[model samples]
Structure formats: structure tokens, C-alpha cells
Target: MATRIAPHEMPMIGRRELVCLIALMMSLSAMAIDGMLPALDEMARELGAANGNQRQLVVAVFLLANGVGTLFPGSLADRYGRRPVLLGTLAAFAACSIAVALVHSFEALLVIRALQGFSAAGLMVVPYAIIRDQFEGDAMARLMSLVGAVFIVVPVVAPSIGQGVLLIAGWRWIFLSLAGVSAIGALWLWLRLPETLHPEYRHEINVPIILRNMGAAFFNRAAVGYVLGTSLLIGAVFGYVNSAQQLIGEHFGAGTWFPVVFGATAAMMVLSNIVNSRIVETFGARRVSHAGVLLFMLVSMVQVWASYAHPGELAWFLPLMAANLGLLGFLGANFGSIAMQPFAHIAGAASSIQSFFRMFGAAVVGLVIGQAYDGTARPFAFALLICSVLALALVLFSEKGRLFRRLNGPVRQEAE
Candidate 1:
């Protein structure tokens, strides 16, 4: 039987363990997207996909599905329980992965990929909801930082893993491998993880109640602004991911070394996350996030200028990309925490709705930016700059132009 401890006696889960669990959950999402990168060309060729650009649709479709899926799972978790809902979602995700691996036609694969993303709603949203269930204020910031730190390792390593699989077993093996990983994750949760939400804390999951909660969340001016900000920021990130391989392989002549260069930039994100984790306690989420938004905008503007000046130099291109992505580590965790702060009572529903908007909005923006790819980095740079500007505007508007406000002093702190 699982060990039981009173709520008060239960030790605050160690930062390492919490980060690992959340990171593992997040890795599931990254693995689904990144692991398929190296295979896009081969999959397109084998499946007879019409346009070269259409290969990107495989990734975009999944993100779109994930966004649509996010809306329902949170309420389901709130009503049923986290563990059961998560398990069910993972089961569906695994089955979809298997289907994706076996499907022969590009259209069928696209359909399966979308379904796989839809199944990922639990993986994408629940972990944050779980973190919110247990933490508040500075504690939540620290936890999110640690989670971000753990997450940093995923993007760095996931593409390399995908490339390795492609070298040995072909692209289909990537999905097969993910299916196996999903099964293990599901079993681990089934065997060890306990339900975090108490029976008394459970919310009713009627359509009326869900619509009311969603409407309230959507109508909140600050929440809506933050949600749009997150979406635009993530849209920029997805735009980069969708085009990174082609930009590196075709434009920069990186070829199979594409993953190596990709991973190098991704490593910079780890450092940024560590920095965020350390300073968030002292500087507060609001201050740090505000600063990050400005820095991101500056970096993106610089990238746009750089791309315009020296469009073909990999040396100039790579560093700008690294700096751009590195800043995202700072933005990712803090935004979620800030957005969810006011909606604590409806953490599940709030997390779900916010995640849905963020993912769906990003998917749409990213897909458009990606389709504009012209065998150059200019499109990516332009997308980043536009998104960054919008993100800054939203942040400023959301905080009523007081984006620079300090935290209400530091509270209890934790180790980074």
C-alpha cells in the first residue's frame, strides 16, 4: 500500500523530487514534439505529403489538438481526481502513439498526431494544477523555478534522443519508444502517486458550472491579458521549433548536426532557469517577469536587426537564437504562477482554460509564422520580434502599467 501521512506531517516534497516529477511530466510533452523533428523529412517522403511545407503540419496539428484538449481535462480532474484523470489521459495518449506509428498515410498520421496531442491535455495542464494545489506565493515561484530547471534538460536532450533513434531504428521507433515511456509513466502513477485533491475540495463538473468558471476566467481583464501574453510568447517559441531544423539543415548546412546545434542553444535555457530559480525569491515573480519581458523584447529586436544585417552567418545566428531561447526559461514558469494566483479557488479550471488559450493561440501563430518560412532565418526573427512586442504590451496592460512593482517583501524561501 502507498504510505499515508497527515497533511501537516507530510514533508514538503523535496525540490529535486518535485522537479523530477514535473520535469518528467513535461518531458512527455517535449518528447512528443521534439522526438518527431528528425523524422519529418523521411515521414513526408514516405507518406507522399503534398507540399514540403506540409510536413510542419504534423507538429502544428498536435499542438492545436493539445490546446483543444486542455479545456475539458482540468474540470474532469477537479471532479474525478488527478491520478485517475491523468492515468486515463496517458492511456489514450499511448494508444494514439501506437496508431500514429502504424498509420501509412500522411493524413492518417496527422489525425493520429492531433489525437495524441488531445490526449496530452492532462500532461500539459495537471502538473501545474497539482503544484498550485500544494503551494502559494514565494513557495510556488520557487517550485516553478525548480520545475523549470528540470525542464531545461528536456529540450536539450530530446532532439538528440530523437536523432539517435532515427540513426538506428527509423522514425517510427520514436513513437514506439514514446508509447513505451507513456506506459511506464502511467504505471508509475498508478502504483505510487496519490490523489492530491481532498474529497471536500472536489468541484462539481456540471456544464453550467464549467461555463460559468470559464466565462469568469475569460472576462477577468488581467487574466485575459496574461493568457494572451503567454500564448504569444509560446507562439514565438513554437515558430522557432517548427523552422529550426530546416533553417539549420538547409540554410546553414548543418545536416545531421542540426540536433547538436539545437541542443547547444537549449543548454543556455538551463542556465537561465537556474538564474530565475535563484533570484525569484529575492526579486519576486512580478519583478523578474517584468524584467524578462523587457529583456526578451530587446533580444528579439537585436535578433531581427542581426538577421537583416548578416542573414547567412551561423555564428551570428546561433548566439542570437540561444539568447532568445534562454530568456524563455525566465518567462515560462513565472507567467503560469502569476496567471493562476488570483484563481486559486478554481485552480483546476483556471489552469485548464489558461493552458488551452496559451497552447491554441501559440499553435495558430506558430503555424502561420512557420508557413512563411523562406529558407532563411528572417521569418523566424520577425515572428519572434512581433510576438515579443505583443507579449510586453500585454504584460504592461495586465499590470495596469505598474509592471515594475516590487514583491510584498520576501516570505519563506527554499533552496534552488
Candidate 2:
């Protein structure tokens, strides 16, 4: 008998189109979070937000929900395929957008936003599994870096877009705009994207299977260590997200200029991704990520000392902070690609476990750092320092005390 390839085991899709579709899908979550930054004060005022610090909850709860919801989407994608699950999640995301816009109370918006986060989880996670389905190793790392390069642009501009909407209308218009974007993305995806999961690779959706696969992923030293490292560093990312408005707008009195300041700072991530895309194929994901984390930790320590010395000074804070954040762009994609490298056959399940650890841990860390906000930047600087150091240790541990070495181990290689 002749061998047979499944329907999903075809040639790779057009790289340009696939990258765009995946980037758009990923941006849905970024838009939901970053776009709301410029409107937090207005949201707080109208929604009866309890206090200044409490306004950060608007982002925190959504992130927490997104992380929690990620626990399921990958397993579901593994069973049912990525396309149908992705489309359904997009619909849910769009629905939540409209619901959030229509809600009369802050509590109602938070509830709907949590649902929105759940939907965003599919957008954030499934695409990575899909990419894993198509590529592996150095190629996969390079492709992911390209995706991250494009994905970082959303954060650079989403706040400005939100601020622009606020100028023409109310904060509710932002959610309405998100609904429109989500609907458009869903339509584009429905038309263009195909199911990437090969039928032969599909797994049954049962609790025991899930637990077993998750256990396999957890037991992989490299995967778990990178995940833990990524988890801690993510606190720095979310801490910034949770406090950027206050740090730049209120503390620095940038106010109306918040978007410009935020966008400029975020542009560092775009630059970092562009550089990583170019260099990652040569340096290898582990080396680049290793160096990036160490640099981030060093910069973080400097920032902590500076923040304490010149408290509330945006002049000293913004540029140094931007440098610290740019390094993150290099770290995130590399770490994730390295972690997923070992689990191609079960990319969906592996991705779920990794995302659960990174995102959920990040949510907890972000909430704590955000809630600890004082009238100064010291808390955030301190939090970043702690997280960065811990992250470095975890990454080193994951590499089995080896840094800047090319890793060779049992790596899965299979047909798409």
C-alpha cells in the first residue's frame, strides 16, 4: 500500500499572507489591552472606578481572564483543528466588544472584558501552534521573530488610535472600533487562512490525555524553565502596561501627550523585533534570548537605582525604560520558539501549558506590581529588577547552567 498524506499536510502557505493573518490575529489582544490605556481615566470617571490605582484593574482583569482561558483553547484546537476554533473565538471577541461598548456600568464592562480576554486567548495561542505545524527549529525561530516584528507595531500605534477615537467621540467608541476590527479580522481569516493541523496529528479531547500531555510538557526541563523565565519577565511587560498611563501621563504630566510618549517608547520593541528577525537565524534563539535577558536585568538594576535617585523624572525614566523594554522583544519570541521546539507533534497542548504558565504567572505578577503603585516609579523599577534577576536564573537553569551554547537534544521533526 502507498503512503498517504493528510489534507492538512500540504505545502506551506504563502509566507507573506500567513504572517499577516497571524499578526492580525495576535494584534486583536494587543489592541484590546493597549488601546484602552489612553481611555483609562475616562473609563474610571464614567464607570465609577474606585481610585487611580484601581483603574489598572481594567487591564489586569482582562489579562487574568486571557491567561485562564488560554488553558483550554490549545487542547480544543488540538482536537477540533485551529481554523474552526479560531473563527469561533473571533466571533466571541467581536461580541464582547459590542457588549462592552453597550454596558452601562464599570462592573459590566469588566465582566464583558473578561469574556473578551477569553476570546483573545484563542487569537494569541492557536496561531503559535499553527506556526509550529508549519515550521521548526531555526526556521521556526526566524518566522516567529518576523511575526513578532509585525505584532509589536500594534502596541506602538493602538494607544494613538484610541486617543484619536476619544477626540472624535467617547471612550465607548474605542470598543465599537475594536468590534469593527475584530469583525474585519474574522472575515479576512475566514476567507484566507486554512486549517494547519494535520488530521494524523489530531488528539482526542479527554481529561486524561490532556493531563498526560501537559505532564510531558511540564517535565521537559527546557520548556518549563523558559516558561518560568518568560513568566517572570512578563511581569515587567504587564507592570509597564498596568502603570504606563500613570508613569508617563500623571507622574510626568504628559497627559494629552501620553500616546506620543507611549508610542515612542513602544517603537523600541518594533526595532528590537526587526533586529531579532535579522540576527536570530545566526545567533540561535537560546544565545540571543540569553544575552537579552542578562542585558535586561542589568538595565533594570540601573533603572531601579535611577528611579530612586531621581524619582518622578520622566527625562531619566523614559529612555532607560524604553531600552529595557526593547530587550523584551528579543527575549519573548526566542524563548517561546525554543520552548515549543521539542513538542511539534503536540504543539497545541504544549503551547497551552506554556501559555498557561507564562500568561497566568504574568497576570499575578502584573497585578501585584500595578497595585503597589505609589506616587513614584520606584515600585515598578524594583519589581522589574526582581523579575529580571529571577528570569535570568530560570533561563540559566533551563539551559542546565549553560549560557550562550547551541542546544542539541531530542527535537521533533515532522511533515506539515
On lDDT, the candidate that comes out on top is 2
RMSD of each: 4.5, 3.3
Best by TM-score: 2
Tens digit per residue, CA lDDT, model 1, 1-416: 01121332253555467668667776887889987888889999999899878899999999999999999888888888788888898889889988988999998998899999999988988887777767766567767878877877878888899989988999999999988998888876776566776555578867888777777665577667778898998898888788877888888888988888888988888888888888887787778888888888998888889888988788998898898888887888888777776665566787888899999999999899888999888888888888989888888888887886754633221100
lDDT of 2 by residue, 1-416 (tens): 01122445564457878888899889989999999899999989998988898889889989999999888889999999998999999889988998988888888878888888877898888999988888777677878888988998999999999999988998889998888988888888777777888888899878888878877876788777899888899877898899889988988889899999998888998899889988887888888999999999899989989987888788898898889879988999999988888787888888887898888889889999988888788889999899988988888788888899875555753212
Using alpha carbons, what is the TM-score of model 2? 0.96
RMSD over all Cα atoms, model 1:
4.5
Clashing residue pairs for model 1: none
lDDT of 2: 0.86
